[model samples]
Target: MTRFYWRKYRSLGVVTTLAILYLIVRAKNYEHKAFVFLANVHPSEPWEFVADFSNMKYLNPTIIDFNLLDESGDYVHWKYSLEYSEKLSHWPHSYNTAVAHFNIKASPKKDSYFIHSTHKTCLLFGLYCLNSVSEFKFSHGNSSKGASCEEHIQYQCPTVLSSFCRREVVYQRKAIMNNLFKKFDGRKF
Candidate 1:
């Protein structure tokens, strides 16, 4: 009788584990909002910076390459690779590299310009449960010389995991912005 019960429980355990794995691998529903950072630059400067694919390699230290695939009017398609760097080598997902496709839109009106970017990884099970969209709104600054740019990065994932990882995601976004600001050489509009 004990042997019989043991086998039943073992089968149940295996099924349960498989179900959890499936949820983790296929969940894909999360939204995270980070603290917005405003940059001192011209509204056009920020939108133009991201529109040019080559600028990513300079703005972001971890990004080694960004290839432009297509551009039609305000829409742009590009693929980028994040390489292993000393700063990311120790993180859980850092060892796993990602090549992702970005769909970007550049919208400029009378007073402001917005850059919207949505991305998905090339691999099916890319990073398990986390996906994100980043938007930057640049408006003419009150000062005649400089413009103000606001960044909002949102991360989406399964509910359980989103709660656990929200803070980390926010911190990561802030770090990215800080890095960009440090690398960017102020360009005159």
Candidate 2:
């Protein structure tokens, strides 16, 4: 019985190793672009909220929000929080807080989407997150240290700045959408 079990276990390990190789090959473009937005998303959404792209080195961005337990074992829904690094007082450091802080528990009234919403208009800014199934928001442009959330840009030409947290507004479509739904359409689209 022991010999039989070992044979099966060895085969399983080999299969898992092959799968990891495939993933690494597919991640070639990950470093090319960085994003930040909602920290998590609803199970219904395709891509869970991705707050940063730096974390990509250790994380595999997923659109599927599932029940997971962190080191504490508490049921915390963790979405793609753009895994990146920064200088802490001039020291290099990785951060996913900007991505983790974004919580979109409202909007579309559903837990879905992976990209960020620049505004209430559902603009494709960067990433999106949903905790319950209500609120939702997006982040765009690059981010830098000492940069304010609304003042930093999450993306720069599809490349997320890896300097500091510079949460800048990349999309104003939300304002336009609000006005359109509010019987106001004088603003540009």
Candidate 2 Cα errors over 4 Å, as ranges: 1-45, 49-100, 106-108, 111-153, 156-189
| lDDT for model 1 | 0.52
lDDT for position 39 in model 1: 44
What are the clashing pairs of model 1? Answer: 29-157, 30-156, 30-157, 41-147
lDDT (Cα, tens digit) per residue for candidate 2, span 110-173: 3232333221111123232211111223222132211111112233222232232122221222
- Among these predictions, the greatest lDDT belongs to 1
- TM per model? 0.62, 0.18
CA lDDT, candidate 2, residue 40:
28
Location of the lowest summed lDDT over 10 successive residues in candidate 2: 144-153
